[model samples]
Target chain A: MSLIQFFNVTKQYPPNITALDDVSVKIDKGEFVFLVGPSGAGKTTFIRLLFREEVPNRGQIIIGGRSISRLKRKEVPLLRRNIGIVFQDFRLLPDRTVFENVAFALRVVETHPREIKPRVEKALAQVGLSNRARMFPHQLSGGEQQRAAIARAIVNNPGILVADEPTGNLDPATSGDIMKLLEEINRLGTTVIMATHAWDIVNSMRKRVIALQHGRLVRDDREGGYGYEA
Target chain B: MKLRTAGYFFRQAALSLWRNVWMSLAAAASVAISMFLLGAFLLLVFNVNHIANNLQSNVEIAAFLQVDVPRQVSLHIQDQVRALPGVTEVTLVPKEEGLQQLSQQFGSEQDLLAATGGVNPLPDYLRVRVADPQSIQSVAEAIKAIPGVEKVNYGQEVVERLFAVVRWLRWLGVGIIAMLGLGALSLIVLTIRLAVYSRRREINIMKYVGATDWFIRWPFFLEGLWLGLFGSGVAALAVYLGYRLVLNMVGPAAVFVPLIRDQGLLLWSTLGLVAGGSLVGALGSLFSIRRFLKV
Candidate 1:
């Protein structure tokens, strides 16, 4: 089933500059896709639009058969709760422990207090950081911090996980480990859309690649590699 | 919000208070000390005003009639005294009644007062109470201007000194207390502002975590409320104990002090101070959070 649809989407920043111009695409449920391009190619804008962080100028984006732009401002939090998001910099609260950080997502969405403990434990186990549950963010290495962030993002069992450069700051070995985890998560039926500039990783992944240039969709290929783009 | 949610927010407020213990203590202390001083000042002013009212009504003028004045003339003089401004009450003292009152005052010397025999020699007089002690002099002079009145006496110099001192003390007490109250209010606001500012990072994190703005804000609001209620409690206790100590210190010289004797008014006013303190603390916290800083 098509879980995400962008029909004739366009986004323009102020002063006559366009971020995403008439870009249209569709992704099936549980699909793992790669978004690739050089800087200013609307890769960030594309992910931001999917999360409804930035609205398109002229478009309709349907996620789970609901129009996003028409949603009221108060409903934005409800929308975001169902969609997990991971960042490049691993934005974790420094004061909270690993378990607290993972549990925070469910707690905020008003999950039952009795259910928070087991859910957080399961998320930490999924991230292979169960032993580090009591550690603060400053105590974790770069890769572990990203894993903890992933645990927080997926703790609510969201149907969609949108990652903006999840492996951008890690070493090559750590990046491979994080990609393997993402693949494992995708196999569990959560659609994953990742934007990255890592040519080697994209080449090895051989997933659906959507490439953009100057706010225009230049290529959408299945089993596509990084070499398909300029 | 559910009770569970409210419980969580209250826990968060307590955690934040503990996290910034020094700032919280400073803010609370400022509120307590300010309220204590204000309570003390209010109590002092109330007692002083009470004493001043007592002193003002104590002195009254007496207009005496000449020996040869007819009974009709003395009645006319009594009516004239009653019509004068500031005259509160006027009672006519007939010659015989005045002689009888003189004998009572003379006590063991009744023989000396009754030596005049049945032909009473005391002058008929109009005993007067002026509304204000300060206006006694003017009212006495106006009484002396009456046609049948021979002399007027209301203890001029003593009343003048007393009225002057009470008015000066009241003015000074108000001025000093007002300045101190303003200073304390500003200090409390600054301390609370610092407290809220240091927590802006936590607020920003809450916003990013898909928590509604109100859900994140409620904890901080509760923290402010808790601090205010606690600080006012402390101030009330301090003021209450301090007032007891003051009463003890002034007991020997209480005649001059004339502290308020009614215990009920004292307690109601103390409760008012506590209420006022809590409100100021709560409002200061709100102002600092909403206006001084934004997350």
Candidate 2:
């Protein structure tokens, strides 16, 4: 079985709004994939289902040999622990320093105090944010804040990294820098899946791209380009 | 959980509590206000009950004898009264002594009695004490049925009225305390709910980062605990000081009417209030945070 599989999945909201309809896909370990679509294209729903944030309405989702479509409420956290999530707004705690923000991920899981510092330092270094550890989120630039958020996500060394428009708030140059960091993390054998509307980055990386249109999977390309215009 | 984990929760709780200092204070103040009222009512109830018990225990049935009843008959009646069920003791007051006591109550009005031709219209009576105040009416009725007894009086109207007042006061105290307690509980819940709502974005981030539900809960729980502790602590102090002040201010004037002055009782009651405050605060916080955890 593939590492992450969605078999004939359908998700619907109230009053007849179908987010993902009868979609089936498989993603293996150590594979970088991009989820490409316009707004309301079910890309966010797909990511939500991957993390068990929302369960499918009519199918099975398997992650790491476990069927998560009907996973227990208590076990949802366990599933999420193996996955790292990034958002467009860079959801770092405003009151905490960058180092504290990264360490927060470990602290919640009751990691020892002695190990929190070094692991946070290493994650910050991975994002090239070693010197900005003492700064707060507001004190950092837009790119730096995203970098801090990325550092927090990867600090747990999760097997899967999912980013939803991580570069949506940054300039083109900074977006490229963020993409390079994600690629480096992927090269380290962590499966990276990013959702984006950045055509240039999509065409340049040429990684696996899965396109969704109106809740249906339209194409799965091993080396896809920005087939649609911005 | 590790000590380090506990320390982390405590630090986080402290930080958030400081961040929302105004809201936290408001919740704590509500708890304090409710607890203070509760403590005051409790003290009132305890003291009133104590005074009532004292008065009831001292109730004595006075069985007045028939006019011209022989002394031998009066002595026999006293013996019979002492033998009756629940009768603790009986003492006879001769007609001469009754007249003497009445004159003494008149207090230096000897000339008035002299003007009445030296005639004493007083009757001999038996003072009857019972084991239980609750049985005073029944015992009085029994004594009235005895031969040679003209009437039985235990100050029936006065005693009944006093007991009614005590009962009413007790019920009123309970009702007021209950209403205040509910008000405090909801206020704390509302304040904590607002606190939770304000921090919901932070909570969502925590959830996305794989933090367990309990992990997100601990800090908030600790915050509630502190609010309860501080609020109730202040309330307990206020109640204690207020009681002490009242006692000192009214102690000498209320010498004839017994008031509760046991330091140990006051201390225990204040401590109980503090405990209740803390529990309410903690449970309120936990309840308020439940829906927000769905994220």
Candidate 3:
């Protein structure tokens, strides 16, 4: 069964400006999907809609058979809890240490204190940042900071992880490393849907690729590479 | 069973509190100053109201008797005064008794009174009180018309003036305190907003991470509560201690009638201040979050 189904989704900002128009797609459970397009290709909007950050103007988004548009406002949080989100800017709390930043995800979900520590440590270890758990965000390198953010995103044991431009800030070497880490996370039974505009990573990986252009889904291909021609 | 959740809520509250210690302190201090000003103004209004009530209840129309008036005639006039309209009570004081009362009133100046040397110059009079304070003038006139009554000295003009002054004062105190309370609310709210803005990134992150709006809102609520709780506590202590110092200093001098005669009332007032402080803090935090910290 499909874990995520977007049915004719349309998102408009203002004055007839459409971000995502009548986009329909299905992502199966445990799938590794890459969302690729230019800067204004509605990739952020797609990720945001999955998390129910903003409601689509006209369409239904189904996750695990639950309809996003049909869900009440109060139910959005529970839906969000099952989905992990990482961002380009890292979004780490400046004051919190790496450990605390990861643990905050568990804390927000009211995870037991005893359960929180082990879960956070495991997430840190998964992201290869176990040793730097005590360091603040600013003290870490850009790659390390993104790792901490990934740890934070997955600490709550989300079934699906959505990363929006997670490698947008890192160098090519570091970006490849982050990509491997995400692939490892995907291998461990968590579905990974990453949004990026990087041609090299997407081309080299040749994963299931979904392409968007001018708010429309241009391509949905298996083992696809980057670029409009491909 | 719910202790774990409670623990998390408070733990988060404390963590965030310490994270922005300076802003928290400023928010707390602003609340404290607001609560203090409100409390002090409250104390003033209460004491003034108390004094005014005492003076008003004690106000009377005094009708002096002529020199060597017959006891039977004075008794008859007393009975007639009692029958007068709006007269609540009429108590007759003999010359000797009246003189004694005067001597007691001038407690420190008893030596000066003793220099009069048994002359018994004080006049016998009937003290008349009216049921309605506003009708004192008519009551005084009626008392003066009674046969064998020499002169009427109700201090009606003075008492009316005092009532007017006291009424004006009550309103003025209320107006000032109300304005000050609003000032405190706005100031604390502004400070809390600053605190909220400082944590805007944290809030955005929380929302993105699937935190319920309440989960995002609770720590801020707790922060505000702590600010109010601590602020009010400080204000109550300051005002109470300050009041005690003033009372102790001025009480011995006997320069004026004691304003706050009831010490127990201060305890109640302190409790009120604490409650108000908490309210202000919580409300300030709520307003700040609602206005500035969008979940």
Candidate 4:
């Protein structure tokens, strides 16, 4: 069964501007898919819809074979538990240490206090930041901060990882490193749906690419290049 | 479901309160001032009402009999009046007994009575004490219809005026208490709002992290509660000290005014101050959280 299915989904903002138009797609488990588009090309909205942050104006979003369009407010948190979202800003709470930031996910999910320490340590080690766990977000380099954000995102071991411009503010080398980390996470059986405008990184990865333009799906290919032409 | 969660919130609230110490102190000071003023007003009202009640209890109607009425007739009139409804007690003062009591009251004034000793001019009278001093007027009117009773002389105008004053004081007390309660509530709300505003970023982060509304709210609510409890505690202490100081300065003579007699009122008022402070804190928190936790 598909991990996520968007059936004829369309999102419209007020004053009659459509963000996503009749977009339908299916993503299977363990597949690494990159959503490539320009600045206003509905990429963030797509990720938000999957997280239930923004409901689609028309059409259904099915996650794990359940229609998520009608999920109750109390059920939204439970839905978020199954999905990990990484923002371009790296949304790390400044007051918390790197270790605490990652551990926060487990704490919110009410994992046992004794179990939280080991799981947080493991997640930090996987991101190769076990030594810098005590450091705050400001003390880390851009690459380290992004990795810390990824650590927090995957600490709960969610089934799907939705990254929106995860490496948007990073240098080219740092962006490439972050992409590799994401690829590693994807290889470990977590389905990663990353939205980015980095053509070179997308080309180098040679993963399945989906292109969006003016809120419409222009192309979907297994070995797609950064093609802009219709 | 357990109080453990409440404990966590209490700790968080206390930490936050200390972190924002200046604002919390300002809030607490305002609460204390408001409660002190309220307590002072309450004390005044209680004492005034007490004095009025004491005066009312001592009030009685004195009915003077005509001199020509036989001694046996005056005794029969006293018995009838004493048996009437609302008559608590009756004392028959004979003409010669009244004269003798007057001579004793004014010791050397016996010579003045001897100067006019040819006749005992003072008339016999009955002093009636009613269950409620307020019923004196009705009792006097009823006694006027009795035979051989020349007239009934209760202080009708004085009693009416005293009751009027008591009623006014009771209403004033109610009004002041209501106003004070409103002031306390507003002060608490403002203080809590300021605290919430200072922690706005923390609240937003909590929300984005998928924290439930109650989870995010619990800390602020508990903070308000703690503030109210502490502020009221301080006010209650101040009030008790003030009461003691006043009592010391005024001495036992203050009891005649009925203001300082009931020491139980002090305990009850102190308890009220603490309870009021806590209630204001809780209500203020509830009001402030509604705006931030819209979902």
TM-scores of chain A across the candidates, in order, are: 0.97, 0.97, 0.98, 0.98
TM-scores, each model vs. reference? 0.69, 0.83, 0.76, 0.76
- List clashing residue pairs in candidate 1: none
Model 3 docking category:
acceptable
Model 3, B1-295: lDDT tens digits are 2567767678867877787787678777876787787777778777766665556657888899986786678788889999998888989888768877787887734664567774666767888888876677788888887778999986666667767776887787778767766766776677567667777887777777787877777777887788789988999999999888878877876435647757798999999999988887788778878854343
Q: Can you tell me which runs of candidate 4 are displaced by over 4 Å? A: A1-76, A108-110, A195-230, B1-10, B61-87, B90-128, B132-199, B260-263
Q: Is model 1 an incorrect, acceptable, medium or high docking prediction?
A: acceptable
The candidate that wins on TM-score is: 2
Q: How well is each residue in A173-214 modelled by candidate 1, as lDDT tens digits?
A: 999999999999999999999999998999899999999889
Relative to the true structure, how large is the alpha-carbon lDDT of every model?
0.81, 0.88, 0.84, 0.83
Q: Is candidate 1 or candidate 2 better by TM-score?
A: 2
Candidate 3 lDDT, A1-230, residue by residue in tens? 79999999999998888999999999999999999999898998998889887789998999999898888777888998888889999999988899999988887777778898889889999999999999999999999999999999988888999999999999999999999999999999999999998989998998999999999999988999998974
Best-matching candidate per lDDT = 2
Which is the better candidate, 2 or 3, if ranked by DockQ? 2
Prediction RMSDs, each to the true structure: 6.7, 4.3, 6.9, 5.1
- Each candidate's fnat, listed in order, reads 0.31, 0.64, 0.64, 0.18
Stretches of candidate 1 above 4 Å error? A1-77, A94-96, A108-110, A134-139, A183-230, B1-7, B59-88, B93-202, B287-295
Q: Is 1 or 2 the stronger prediction by lDDT?
A: 2
List each candidate's DockQ score: 0.26, 0.56, 0.47, 0.26
Instruction: Note the residue pairs that clash in candidate 4.
Output: none
